[model samples]
Target: MNERDILIVGGGIFGAAVAYELARHGLGERVLVLERLQPAAGATSRAAALLTMVRDDPGQIALARQTFRTMAELEQELGEDIGRRTVGALHAAPASHLAVLQARAEVAAAHGIASTWLDKAEALARAPWLAPESFDHAVFFPDECYVEPYLFATALLRAAIARGVRCEASEVKRVVVDTGRVWGVELADGRRRAASVIVNAAGAWANRLSVDLGLPLPMAPVRSQYWISEPAPIFPRDGAIVLLPAIRAYARPEVGALLFGIRERQPAVADARTLPADLAGFVFDPDDADGWANLAEGADELAPCFPALNTLGIAHYLTGPSNYTPDRQLVVGAAPMIAGLYVASGCNGSGISFAGGVGRLIGELIRGAAPFVDPQPSAPGRRGAFDPYAPDFLAACAAARAGKTSG
Candidate 1:
């Protein structure tokens, strides 16, 4: 077996980010990334890619602020365009969330993120499509932006590879463990590679490898689906990303179309073992099997804010599994039962937004450098032993996604 310094088992945003951070710290030659599929081909490919800076947690806010700085440095070093759209974001909710929005706006200002509370007329002026009186309160962040997730993830991996980090198209079925530590990894082809450190960034299939090590991560694959409206004159090419937590929905402009996501009353959850290598073939909705049913379910709450919902042409549907923890935080840090095994899963539907931060944290932790953000809240072993593939655990994870207040 070939000895390695670090072996990351997934090529999605988390794994790619970790590799880039390690390479940035001058450990590229010793790192290797193994992907079952192409980079960003899983959940990363389907992410909404919202970069919301204002959050409930101070740790998350700090992490999010670092994301912008990290991405800016990466782009300059790699000369890659991440397709950033800086139209900003608007949070329109009922009066019930006014104080919460006000508090969050204060948090944003403290972080040097400019935000303003918009009156009804101003809200409609910015988002002419919004129903003027649908929402009682609206907060606008003028500097918020988003990116093309695939390009963002792949750019990070490409930068890492360019800096001597190696990547291969291979699937790691399980980590080779002995003496209470990870020795290496065994691939599906029965090939083994030695690694001093193994980071399980396998995303939806992360738990599959961990469960075999007698350490099932407290996370599950939950379906996150969204619909795109067909191109129309009403939908501007650069409309601001809209957040409506009152009705549990959000929308952004998708090239002259409105791309919206609705949090179903009971979001879909899946057994990680049953997931296909290609998520495109998976069916997320089990009810009427209509992804549009989610829109209908939230129509009552959404219609007031978005009257265009009734007239918009449904264009496309994107569905995939996002690793979700009950607390809706990234599962980072080393696994307690297995030494030298780091875990970074549980994106909670914000992988794109949090990729850079996760990468930096994983890299810092592995390099013995102090982390930019405190890692206590996201420790992987914080939750007790439980089968991630089990139904009750899956429900808990699904509940987290359903109850998520942030993007």
Candidate 2:
């Protein structure tokens, strides 16, 4: 019986951050992290790693602020570079979507985030590969950057481990509950462990662990895929991330090559129960069969952004589950009736962006400290009626992705 004060399941960005924050609050020696696979090896590794902080949601803006600050602090404390590239992000929108852009700028202003509107010539100067004629408006967020998500999560875990938090490679089959409160977790081998508090930060596969709970998170898994181009000088390594809302596309510099992804009309939705422990075991394209059709669908829209987009040598095609809720907000808070049980999943495809804040909020809740930001908007019970695996509910979640043009 390994008794601990805090036990966190899943060692992705969220879990790692939670463990690190708990250690920072003087709960290091008493914390335990159980990661079935490797830390950040799950969906966290496949994250797009975009840190576009000027978001439409003010809460997200506030949370993103903490994440940006925490990244720098981790680099300083750990004495290692997290590989953060401050190339900034350019949101290029058409006339019809100008209102949305303006609204986001206003929100950024209120949150003290720097946002500046750039003329077509200036925007083109930032991303020469992008087609200036395709967009009617553009805004630049100089603080934005694309980082290596794996490095970020592992650095947090390393710091937490240095503070005496123990982690083991073991899967948690279920959480132990008695007297309507969580006590510990039951492993696959029928072994039980004791912990005073348990936080579920299990990324895309989180629903599998929470379905039996009285209050399961109202979210489902959706496939988020992206492609990388072979090295090409046409793709500048120093260029800013280009976001085209009109065509539903985003591109960033990837080591002298171009990396990009375009949202599909109906993104693939999967039941977390059917997903494999290793994300590589899952297949994303059943309809397209060979996968070329899906590739072509996205390429057509992004073709105008780069002249060689269609002809470029595609070096890699990466895909992973990005959990989503209908409202497009994170699900991070304590379980409704399961005392001492907290969930920090439901990233809505922004897990990497929100991991720091999620960890901080969970730490605050468990320690009874005042939260840095309000967490009610993303509470579990706010919209919990939908069955995550149901067809209609999955459709709703996929619809959210289809309509999402920005971040």
Q: TM-score per candidate, in order? A: 0.96, 0.96
Tell how far residue 348 is off in model 2, in angstroms: 0.5
Q: Whole-model Cα lDDT per candidate?
A: 0.84, 0.85
lDDT digits (tens) for residues 329-362 of candidate 1: 7788878877889998888888877878888888
Ten-residue stretch with the least lDDT total in model 1: 284-293
lDDT for model 2: 0.85
Q: Residues 1-407, candidate 2, lDDT per residue (tens digit)? A: 24476889999999999999999888889899999998899888987888878777878877787889889889999888997999988888879989877877788788887889999999888888777667889998888998899999999999999998999999999988889888899999889898879998888878788878756677888888888889887677889998778777888889988888888888888878888899876776676533467778876667766677767788887888888889998889888878889999888888888888888999999999998889898887677655678888888888888877775
Residue 84 accuracy (lDDT) in model 1: 76
Query: How many clashes in each candidate?
Result: 0, 0
